[model samples]
Target: MGDTNSDSPTASPEAAFEAPPTATVSLREDQLQNAVSFLSHPKVRSSAVEQKRQFLQRKGLTDAEIEEAFRRVPEAPAAAYVPAPSPHSVVAVPAGTVTPAGYVPVQQQQLVPAQPQPVRWGQAMLGAAFVAAGVYALKVVVWPYVADAVTKWKASQGEMAEAKALQEKESNALAEAIQAQTSELRNTVELLQKLTVSLEASVAESKRAAQDSLSLADLRAELRTLAGTIREQRPAAAPPAPSVDVGRELASIKQLLANGVGT
Candidate 1:
């Protein structure tokens, strides 16, 4: 138990001499200032940036604003622009460079197209006269002639109507004349019929007279026979019957009657 205790590990002098010391190399104020000055140099420009400090001091830029500006810094973009003219007008400007021409006032030129030549009073009057003449001709000569022709045509038509009426009247008169002629012809035929009847009556009367004459002749012949018989039978009575040749006496009487009838 004593050996076990003597063999147990414990801190020794050589082990202590081998152990590390806790001594620190503390920085001095001059050394720290020298290091800060070296880093802050304009050429090196480290340690929170002397450039940012100088820029904030000289140009009134904050450190965060300067960092933002530096971060945004890229190569400048190329652009085409016309610069305003210098206040002193120098002769070194290139040919086509523009100045502040917009600021200057300019008077606009009054532009008017050329007016066509006006028609002369005489020519215009002549054109108007021609139109008026045409209108006058239409109203006076042409229209009147046309109207006269229409009137004449109407008159001719009226006359033709009159002539047609006259013709119709004449035709009616002709019809009346023809009807009268026909009536006259009918009357003439009636007269001819009456004449024929009269002629027939006259013929009947002539035949009756002939029959009467025959009967009278027969009675006379019988009387002559009786006279002859009486004369023969009786003695010559009363002066020999006047020596009567009856035949000769009858012939003389007939001759007298014939002469009277002729008269």
Candidate 2:
């Protein structure tokens, strides 16, 4: 019995030694810090706790390690809740009941007149001074330049009008001069035509006179040949003279020839 008890105690210790060891996973310090930072991120913090846990689990984190990281994360500040009265809710009150001492009546609250804001005289005066300065600048500086430009433009327009008128006058004078020259030229041409006609007539008269002179010369030559034939055919013996005077007859013939030459 004593050996069995000792063997039983040894067998129990051997069974304990032969049993499978439990596995434990521990995150590194940097990994824990990273998990804390990820959980603390604004987007991750704004998400649902379950969704954040699932996202961390997808990144290889166990639930315990994620819980540890969440513990390290800072909590967000809680917002104060303000309650508003419901529009539909009404409180019942008796008609003649006395009101609280410090309560404002609804009619007086609604009918309270707004206080008027005091006018800033300094600002008004400053704006007025600026307006006066602008007016002064417009009247004293800008107006004169604008008026001068307008006056100059008017003067230039008048000058242009005068120039156009002068140009038109010059054109009219040139046209008149051209017309006068044309009339003079026409008169000169007519005079030249008349002179040409007179010259042609004079030339024709001269040609007729030349033909008459040639006819007179031919008549004189025929008279000379007739006188020579008469001398050659006359008788050599002296004969009794005729009653007619030959010298008188010869003088009459010379007179007729002189009359023909004059004609």
Candidate 3:
């Protein structure tokens, strides 16, 4: 049976495989848009051509979702894909200037007349003579007053400048005096502070010394009272002569007893 099966014709793997599917997998509209946007990227456009489903998978889409999206992409019309115009390539003409093909540009309004006619040479010469006369009169009559006014203004300005300089000098001197006074005040304050600190220390020392002296005086007084009390508590013994007489008498008695009493 094995030898007979081996001899029989076997189907090739390629022949057994199913044909390429024509029907696209159904996908969401948004997924289809995402696939189109990914392909529209400059880097994706320049990359080696691959299956659209694989490209969608690279864009973080699931395999099943990519298959669904790929199905709908073929249905999208090629004419619907419009290339984005470059900013530098597109030029805009003014709407009023551009006329449609075979379009008659009807007049919107009648044109206004040009500016008034040019003046004659005689009138120009007369106007120039009047200006020259006015200039000459102003030079003879008004110029001296103007010059005087300008000179006065300059003199006043100089006086003001001098006054300002004097005021600035005075201010500087005053500032220096104030600074010196402030330094002197600071030194005086420091000296007074030192004196005050020393005085406070001396006072404290004096207070401590006074307290110690009071304590010493109280101790001395206590010692004097204790000495007086001890002196008062001491018993006064009888006269030393009587003590000697008693001792002599006791010695006489002892001699008599040694001699034998009655005999």
- The C-alpha RMSD of each candidate to the native structure, in angstroms, is 32.0, 15.4, 30.7
User: Model 1, stretches more than 4 Å misplaced?
Assistant: 1-140, 233-263
Name the best candidate (by TM-score): 2
Q: Regarding TM-score, does 1 or 3 come out ahead?
A: 3
The TM-score between candidate 2 and the true structure equals 0.44
User: Per-residue lDDT of 93-158 in model 2, one digit per residue for the tens?
Assistant: 578998788865443123457899899999999999999999998899889999999999999999
**lDDT (Cα, tens digit) per residue for candidate 1, span 1-263:** 11222222342211111112244234322222222333333333422455444633343333454444444432234577989765444455456977675645334455678999987999999999999999987898789888999999999999999999999999999999999999999999999999999999999999978876776676567667967885686554456554466566666767755654453
Clashing pairs in 1: none
Clashes of 2: 0
lDDT score at residue 77, model 1, on the 0-100 scale: 43
Regions of candidate 3 where Cα sits further than 4 Å from its true position: 1-136, 237-263
- Clash count for each candidate, listed in order shown: 0, 0, 0
Can you write out model 3's per-residue Cα lDDT over 1-263, one digit (the tens) per residue? 11222222342211211222354455544444555444444444445446545545555555666555445433333456778765345345577886679965443454678999987999999999999999999999999999999999999999999999999999999999999999999999999999999999999999977876666666557656855764576458766775576568556655644433322
